[model samples]
Target: MPGCNNNSRLSAEEVQELKQICRYVRKMIINTVADAGCGHTGGSLSEVEILVGLYFRIMNIDPHNPSWQERDRFVLSKGHASPGYYSVLANRGYFYEGKLADFNAIDSMLQGHPCMVKTPGVDMSTGSLGQGLSAGIGMCLGRDKRGLDFKVYVLMGDGELQEGQIWEAAMYAGFHKLSGLIGIVDYNKVQLAGTVVETLDLEPLADKWKAFGWKVLECDGHDIGEVVDTIQKAKRMSESGPVVVIAKTIKGKGVSFMEGKFQWHAKAPSESERKLALEEIDSCVE
Candidate 1:
């Protein structure tokens, strides 16, 4: 809430710009994933709007000085979604856009999962599911110790919530009253193997978080305006402990063939598939 309370809503032009930016990020994801020949496609596509909303409009970060003392911290709990994370960081000027071409290469900075030591603007090195919230809590505590008001935002996958460590971290954050911390769950329904319902249902998800003393918020994950608005409300809740936004999104968002399918969860598009995906994303630009 440190830098989020004032002018939180986006103007019409800003909303359009954010949408275009997200589209571009999606394009980057498609290209990078296909070119790399191995990457998580569905989850990365699903989280485009959430990542764009945060990096471009929500979080107070300095791309040039990624390690600035006062910068807000972000933890990508669903680290397999590194394509989306890396694309957003590149578009945000954290690194040169050309570097994206080397994603997932033998010795590239943009590896399969996000690494703070390897990539700029990545606050936490996360690949294992459910550990990001714990890391985010630690970040908040460190900022508190330093008397810094910077907030911490953690992005997670709905399937990752099946991990017990996630629940432990949630309880810890809630009990400690980490008001400056926010958790976002990309509820895209599908996971690596199959749908979350078939794998392990987390029904009544909002209620579960509320039971843990977190302020639960819900929004359409792909809608930048709604996501930003929900984040604004989370920022406005004064000292009400930690907040979590359950964002409903579609896996493989922008591509007709991949949307809602689990096969794209970690497979790269073929040449034809990549062309089709790019065409669909280009249609969304205006």
Candidate 2:
């Protein structure tokens, strides 16, 4: 059993710092998509705060030693949006910022999907939909059986919920009483093809989780304060099976033209569009 005695909790100042990092991460996503000529900019932007809250405030990670036994685990099930995840990882000292320029480049560590073998901070190589929760459940169960108290956090796209496997994993987590596991659904309402509601609705999503015997909480994914608070609440409620935090976010949240539009899901920004995105993100900075 791995000792969970490490201090993973963040102070109020650290929360503020994480919020700032999220803003930079959003900018990095916009720029990376613009430079790469192809990427999931919308969904990536929508999950910035969630990633930030986890990496900086909630998860017990050591950038120096990513595979530390006592560290909490995070899996990005929506792996196409690796730009955002990579940005956060880099900002947290997993790698250098210069590495971001090689994103999606041939033979680069930054592939379109997260590759645990290639990236240093990535815990699991996830790209296929509906699999991350299962992996998270496995980690949670492993930790439990080992008498470890570290938590496992999994982030899923809303569209991914349409897959039957997601529900199965949810049920399994609840049935096993994997209280140390936490799943966050990025409910951006849009998928690659269209709005999640128009494609395959997962409405009354929170209720569905509750029905599975898991504690469910909802928050604004873009709001750093709310996201942090919701995660804290989930951590404290771990005694009652697993917990799911449904975060309502806007696809392409920071960019004006891209926000709320499904077109930006996997669209690369054109040269002019890149300039516009940079301008928009620059304005958001203090």
Candidate 3:
């Protein structure tokens, strides 16, 4: 672990190091997208910090024991954001970092979306929208049945909330009082076609989750301290239902030209654009 200090817990310095890791993760994402010739860059970049916070700071996971009974489960509901997820997994020692160079190439383990069968650390194969929460709920229910203490965390794109199946899962989780489950919404507000408001507004989103009987929390996704603190708080809250963390974030956060732009949602950068994006992300490293 290049950034790992001796502590088992994430210290202030470690959090800072993780932030640097996120920067490199963003750079790797930019390079991969550039090579892939097509990808969901905006959403991927927007969720990088949150993924870093989870994989490095929050989640209790083991790369060596991926299927360990006590390991927490993470489901990437926004599967198109796999670039961020894969980058974090690689940095966390899930696989060889060199394999990242072959991202999206023919015969590569990294497809455009994450595949659990191909990827070492992926818990579930996901791409279809609105299904991850259900899978997470199943895991939580299974753990509860087995009397296990593990938790399940799922990340969903804000636009994915438009899918009716998500609400069904939410209703079930709340009704069953699945307290072991946590769902984080990446509220970047930009989807593939356009801004979420233009497609299907998820405004009053947190309230909807609360109404569904979840303990809801909101935070700035880019703030590592806030991300860690909120998730820890959510874990401690006494709730007979699921928890939802609404993470407000900017699409293409680190790159000025791509920030808040819908066009970058599913488009790859050209070589020139990739050079600029890499330089911009690199400037944030230190």
Strongest candidate by lDDT: 1
Error of 1 at 55 (Å): 0.7
Score residue 140 of candidate 2 by CA lDDT.
Answer: 81
By TM-score, rank the candidates, best first: 1, 3, 2
Worst 10 residues of 3 by lDDT: 1-10
Error of 3 at 253 (Å): 1.1
Candidate 2, residue 11: CA error in Å?
Answer: 7.9
lDDT values, one for every candidate: 0.90, 0.86, 0.85
State, as a TM-score between 0 and 1, how close model 3 is to the true structure: 0.94
Give RMSD to native, each candidate: 1.9, 2.6, 2.7
Residue lDDT tens for model 2, 162-205: 98999999988888787888899999999988888889888788
Measured with C-alpha atoms, the lDDT of residue 208 in candidate 3 is 92
Q: Where is model 1 more than 4 Å wrong at Cα? A: 1-6
TM-score of 2: 0.93
lDDT of 3: 0.85
Error of 2 at 7 (Å): 9.8
Please write out the lDDT profile of model 1 over residues 1-286, one tens digit for every residue.
1332333578899889989999999999999989899899999999998998888877888788888889889999999999999999999999999998999897789989998999999999999898999999999888889898778899999999999999999999888778788999999999889999999999999999989889999999988999998876886662568999999999999998999999999999999999988998898655
